[model samples]
Target: MQSALLVNGTLISDESVRQEDILIRNNRIISTGNNLSGQPGETNIIDAGRKYIIPGGIDPHVHFALPTPEGCSCDDFHSGSLAAMAGGTTFIMDFVTPAPGQNLIEALSLRRQEAESCLLPYRLHVGLTWYDHTITSQMQQCVNEEGITSFKVYLAYKGSIGIEYHELEKVMHAAASLNAIVLVHCEEGDLILKKQREFVAAGKTSPLYHALSRPPETEASAVKKVIDLCRKTGCRTYIVHTSAAKSLQYIRAAKAEGLPLYCETCPQYLLLDESVYRKPLPASLKYVISPPIRGREDREALWVALRDGTVDVVATDHCPFNTFGQKDKGADNFTLIPNGAGGVEHRLALLYTYGVLTKKISLQQFVALTSVNAARIFGLFPDKGSLRPGSTADVVLLDPDYTSVISADNGLQQCDSDIYEGMPISGKFSVVTAESV
Candidate 1:
């Protein structure tokens, strides 16, 4: 591969920043400095126009080609990874749902094949998405093959993907034995379903009931329940899409107890509100995620968690769904509405614009949530998410002063609509390079 010089930008890595020229040999980041000062030569210069050249973001929880309540996720490997790149993300860990009675290794291999032939030119990592007995054996395959180092178990969704109490315990115990981390979607499905039925039966079928159905208590209870099981099983656990501040407090206390627990929050929880669900038409359904968005109090609480270091990472959970027929499918029955919004094209920008500009989190912490922490947790550090000397040259150039209006059209997500449409953002990804770039 030809050598190239990435010059004149604020090089932001896992650690500090420097105005340096990064040398790329093949796909590896060979050197970094001004003028390659006192180092090797023979490289073509690619000026960065003095943008912020940071490590490529690593989004740990994204469900592409994911099957859900409404339908399979709107974004597939090709479209999802394109949005990931357009948003300055270079690597993503997508879940591979193992077929019943299929080998975990084979399932992962199939996922890899899809990714290799995928149209999107970005790095893809696989994780085992488990529902039943597939957890134990597939986890062993993830461990043995190292194709996947993490697994997701739903604590709250007892109806569909939700695991029963014993199944939850068994999965946690299995994960504990395999040294794999279990990430849970922590909204109690039983309580949520009961509330849904009651609300609908009473003729209260508005979108507001979506939140009412899965109240914060639903999430908190499921968190405590899952954490208790994790404690008993001695497993490493992470709460995915943590919304309520009270739930975060529980995890904070567990961390105080030295529990092997970690948690992640999303942009919607920080930037939007439950009121989004009340918006007319497409707008309301756009924010219809599980463990529903909370009130201002919970939103502020999440900011505090991100500030005081109670939270570990801030991933987009970049699971894109349609705002038209897809999300609106369940408008008549909120349960049928798919529970996610598109943000792979906006995760980093949203965090940078909202997190740092608003002073809710520091730039260093932004780098941590968007990069370092994810790479650390997902086991793809130096190679996929870092800017170290030996790491891949994958990077994103951010022009902090540049402003842009975010619309459904500009976004790279395969979905038809964007939840954050028309929102003005200051920072933008001006350029991006992947390992194979």
Candidate 2:
């Protein structure tokens, strides 16, 4: 086992920052406090020297090597994990969407095998698109035997991956029975399909129309539906990649009533807006993500949500596709373009610059949004998201003074276009250490 000591660093916890030294052995932090000592030959000493030592970020939502009809996302486990680590994210919770007629356990087994080469430790949230006795039983097996505590459901993508209303209620009941958390993609599928038809018929099929087709109401309506179901069934529910400010009202009301409901928004939702859809032809397609970026008002609302605790975490929702082959497939029709963006390699630095440096949120709030909250919600708390003693030694050294501009050439994801290109950013990761895989 390799043992090491990190000296003279300010540790960012959920509450505050404190100067401390951390001692690591066998890939775990054995102790953390002032004046920690280590034997010379037994432990290597790393002088952190005024850097911020924060727990490695855990992105609760990420899709790596996702298979779509167009093609697999450009970033697989290997490249995605590398990008995540480069950005100081130590663990990610990805999904396992089983194929038609495929057993849930088998799908998880195969996905785990496929992800054997991933550099960082990872966990899976099984997607339950359809429900039956067998599938319901499998859900229990996943929680009990596979150690997966979170399940995902889609309210959009109708006919394909979306869950029917009645079936979703039953699934929620089942999840509640097992004390499992349900994560949902909240958007009314039928409403989006109808709007798409209207847009295409009017010869308005540009990339900008992608945003027009799914208006804020589409997401807000679905968010309300999930909240109602969670309230009825008593299941802990989390909404993913929430992009609309209208949806925040529902989340806020639910939280006020003490419902076990939580929601996460991504970096693009906070910083980017719908204008990206109107950029150039091929360049604009990169921002055609689902639940597309909203107006400037919504962007400001997300920042407020982060500050006031309406938004529990900030994740990447990182599903990267190349511009050449993947995005060009939908040149004539925006609907064909795969929806996602690459941000795993830039999440930490971007948030630090915009969220912390700009005074929108405090450093402690940043730590909670980036790491601690997700850990507690997703059952990886002390082990993965805290710098406390006996926690897995997943640590990041953040240099607050570093400054740079964003570009694809310096990123680790297997992608051609950088959505945040030319964006000025301060603060970079000096070093990152992940627990043994």
Candidate 3:
């Protein structure tokens, strides 16, 4: 790779933003400082014009090109990572579901091959599952060879991704031994299925009923189980796409008891609510995430947790289902909706627009949520989430003073829809640096 100097931008990695020049030799950042003038020989020069620079974001929980039985999510690795780069994210951890009768390693190989075909810019993290003990070592290969060190286990979805609490114990024990992080999608599957049936039987088939069927009680109960299991195994656990405010209590209690437990919430949970779907025909199917987007009260609570120390990180559970083929599958009832939203393109902007600019969080905290803490937790620290020496030249130059009327017209994702359509953002990324931008 040709070397480059990303000079004179406000470099904001971790909590600090400095007007510095960054030097990239090969793929790693070699040096950084203020008003850096590049030596013209051999080094490619990039002038930032003094815009804010951030560690290109690291989205630890996104599902790309994942075809659910119901409908297709909008963005593929190419389109999704393009939108990610356009929005200032440099790396993503996407899940790889094991194919029918295939083991975790086989699934990972297929996903890795698919990702390579796109010649994508962002570094992608491979996600493994502990559905079968036979593949635990194979999942470890993702970390050992592929640099994919994280795994996910769902507490919802019945026999599918949901491993029983005992299986969760097995996952925790194994991950602890492997030194990998375990992410949990915590909602009681049996409860959701029972409640879904009850809603259908009781004629509560509206989109809003989706939220009602998978109640907060379901999340709290299952999360408690997952937390306890992690505690027993001495494994570090992350609560993924945490939606229910009460569930944070379980995480908090685990933390208080000195368990290495962490939690991540989404912008949808912090911004939108179930009430949005309460339209007569239920436009709310648009926000049907697994632990569904909650109410205004829950939103405030999540914000409070973020502002406080209870929450560890903020990630867009960027599972995008296009409004037509994906989301429309649930047109008859909310339960059939594929569980995700298109937001890798919108995460940093949303946080910057609402979280920092609005004073819900400090710009420092915004950096932590979007890049710093996520990097540390996922073992990509310094290399992927910083402007320091030996890090990827991946960076996002931002115009905080600029404003845009956000819409799908400018969207880079292949998906036809976005849930946050029509919102305005104060900042937009003007330049990106990688092997290629």
Candidate 4:
């Protein structure tokens, strides 16, 4: 049996942090306590002095190898997982997007095959791209047989992948029936399309116009609509990449009403602002993600939500494309740019520096946002998000004193440019251990 012992580290969980030693056998944590011992010759003893040992992060939102009209996203499963591992994430959840009229199960199987190259343990949230009588049964089959408990739906792609309110309601009902959670990309489709047309017609076809087209109201309206549907259908709903301050009031109210609503915001929405879009041609293009990075008020509001428990998780909607080849395609028209940027490799470090060091959030809250809460919401808790005995041995040893500047060249992601380029980060991952089950 493979064995190892991590000694003299501060172990942190969502609940507490304490100095402890963790013993591991094979892929499981054997025990954790003070002075845990193992055979000297047979076991690997790691000296984790002055390091903070936390559960490996679980990013519930990422889009590796996502196919768009321009091309597939730059990082496929293997490359994306490598970036994730380097950033201290051990388990990641990606989506299984089905083609029109394709079988959901078949799509999931193919996605699984593609994900086989991933270096980290992973899960998939099946996308509900269309509605049909067969979809309910398909969702049930996915949950019962495939172990997929979460479904995703888009509200902004309009005619292509975006579903109408009626369709969303039907999906919410189906998810409620199966006790599965629905992750919604909250943007008003019609408003976005109308604004895009207006911007293009007015000759304002720049990256900044991308943010103008999908304003805060567009997101906030969708959030309110989804919360209403959740209340009506009693479906557990999660809003992904929430980027607006106005949207938070709806989320906060829904959560206060005891509706099964969870809100997730990405690091970009928290750290970056709409000002990045004002930078220059391609430099600004990299930040043109859907629900485009908002203004300073929105960023500060998201940080408040993160600290106040209004935000449930922080994930990177980490779909990346080359700035030259892909994003530049939309230079003449902002609508054509692939709507994403790379952050899977930077989520933990960014959160540690900005959230923890800045006192915006505590270390325990950091653990919760980065790993624990996502696992619990997505049903991977205790095993994937915990350092308890018998839990999967996915742990990260983070050195608090180490600091570094982030750039695409040094990052493991396959993307050519980074949105977080030149951002200084404190705390580095000294050791990452992921034991396979």
Candidate 5:
């Protein structure tokens, strides 16, 4: 690989930002300091004038090419990785969900084939859908041989993928034994099912009712359950795509008690409110995700969590479905709507525009939430989330003054509709480099 020298830019990290030059060689950062030098004509030299160079983002929660009943999510690894690179995310950690009767290793292999078209280096978080005696041995193989240190479990979607509380405890016990982290989708399945039945009985089956079916309390209740289980099992736990204020309070309390609890909220929950669900049918259906987009109070509370350290990272769930062919399949029933939104291509710019520009968080906090925190929590660490010497040369050059109107028309994903259409954004990724791994 060709080496390069990046000069005259501000280097931003989780802790600080400083004007520095960077030398990249053999897919790793060889040096970073003031007035970095390189042999003329031997190394490529690029000037990042008036731009901020930060670690390429690491999205810890994504479902690229996720299979659904009707078909697959709109973005496969090919298009998904393209979108991620455009948004300055160079590495992704996607889930490996086992189909019914499939082993964890088989699921991992299948997902690897699905992600073979990926343009960036990626990792897997094996989702433990069902538990068997053989699962314990499989979990060990995944951690030791596959180098997968995280596992995902859902508390909703009961029959399809969700596991019971006892099963969750068993999974945590195995993960703890291997010192692996467990990521949970915390929404009480029974509560959601009960609400769904009530809503259907009341003749309220529109997209708006999707949010009503899975209330904030459902997520908060499940979050408490998982935390308590993790506490008892001594397993490190991460709550994924947390979207409720009450859940944040529980996570904060758990952390205060010295629990190794970490949680992440998506940009959708931070920027869009449940009010989107009240929009026109086609429009609202785009935001019909699990533990759906919450109200303004929850959005505000999520931002506060990021500011106050109650939340550790910001990730885009990045599961996209087209309105015409994909999401519209559920027009008659909200429950059938594919639950996801397109954000991998817009995460960094949106966060910079909304969080950093509005002064809700500092630039340092922005780096922490977007890159470092996820890296540390998910075990990517100094290699993927930092620009330090010896780290992977995954860097993004952002133009703080770049102006653009966000739209799916210009986005790189395979998804059809743009949820953030016409929203004005200030910063843009001018240059992105994802070195080969």
Candidate 6:
């Protein structure tokens, strides 16, 4: 059996941080406590002095090898997973978006084949792009046979991937019956499409107009609608990449009423704002993400939500498109720009510097947001999120004193441009260990 011991490290969990030594046998953690000992020549001992040993991060959202009108996303599963591991993330949950008329199980199998090159353990949340009487049975098959427990439905890309509220209600009902959670991209598609037409007509087709078209009201309205549906159906629902403050009020009220509504905000939503769209040409185009980055007030609201537990997880909507070929394809028009940015390789360092060091959130809260909460919410729990005995031996050793600036040239992601370029960050990973399952 493969065995290793990690000693003299401060172990961080969702509830607390304390010095503990962890013993691993094969892929499982054998124990975690003070002064753990292993027989000489039988086990390898590794020192983790002055480091914070925490559960490996689980990014609950990412798009690898995603096919769009322009082309496939720059980073495939292998490259994206490499970037994830470089940033101390051990497990990632990506979506399996089915094509029109594609069977959910078949789509999942195909996505699994594409993800075979991924370096770390991963799971998929199947997308319900189109609805029919057969969907309910397919969802059950996915849960029982495929180990997929989450369903993603978009309310943004209308006529393509997005479904109407009535369709969403059906999906919610089906998912609720199966005890599965629904992940929603909460943007009013009709409103966005109307605005897009207006912008293009007036010749306001810049990236700035992209943000202007999808105002906070659109997201807020969709959030409100989704909350109402959750109350009606009693289905657990999660809002993905919640970008506006107005949206949180509805989520907070839903949760207050004990509704099974969860919210996720990305680093871009919390740290970057609408100002990026105001920058020059191609520079502005990269920030043209869906439910575009909101204003400073929304940014501040997200930070407050993170501190107060309104936000459940901080995942990177890590879809990357190169500026030269992908993003700039729509240089004369904003809608054609593939909406995504890369941050999987910098989520930990950026959050550690801005979130933990700045006191916006505590170390325990940091652990929860980055790894623990995601694990618990997504049903990975002790196996992937905790350092408890019998858990998967996936750990990250963080050097608190280490500091560096983020640049695309040094990043592991295949993309040529980074949204967080030139951002200075504190703390770096000293060692990241993930025992393959």
Best-performing candidate as measured by lDDT: 4
Which one wins by TM-score: 1 or 5? 5
Q: Return the lDDT, model 1, position 110.
A: 83
Each model's C-alpha lDDT? Answer: 0.76, 0.88, 0.76, 0.91, 0.89, 0.90
Q: Residue-wise lDDT of candidate 2 within 91-163, one digit each (tens)?
A: 9889998877689999999888878888888898999866666877898899889888889998888878887
- Expressed as tens digits, the lDDT of each residue in 1-437 for candidate 1 is 25766778787764676778887777778878777732345455667885788888877778788776467888888888777887888777777666544566777778777677454334333343345555577578677866456777666655445567677788778888877788888887777878988999998776788888988888889888888987899898888999997898899999899988888998888888787767776567777777687899999999999877778888877776877768877777776777777788788999999888888777778888888887787677777667778887777788888778888886677777777888888787744432223
The list of candidate 6 runs beyond 4 A from truth reads 430-437
Candidate 1 residues lying further than 4 Å off, grouped into runs, are 37-42, 99-106, 119-135, 430-437
What TM-score, computed on C-alpha atoms, does each candidate reach?
Answer: 0.91, 0.97, 0.92, 0.97, 0.97, 0.98
lDDT for residue 91 in candidate 5, whole number 0-100: 86
- Candidate 6 lDDT over residue span 283-308, tens digit each: 99889898899999999999999988
Model 5, 38-82: lDDT tens digits are 767667788888999999998988889898896888888988998
RMSD of each: 2.8, 1.9, 2.5, 1.8, 1.8, 1.7
* Least accurate 10 contiguous residues by lDDT in model 1: 120-129
Colliding pairs, model 1: 156-187, 156-189, 157-162
Model 4 backbone overlap count: 0
Name model 4 segments beyond 4 Å from true: 434-437
Q: How many Å off is the CA of 4 in candidate 1? A: 2.1
- Quote model 4's TM-score: 0.97
Clashes per prediction? 3, 0, 5, 0, 0, 0
lDDT, candidate 6, residue 345?
89
Candidate 5, lDDT over the whole model = 0.89
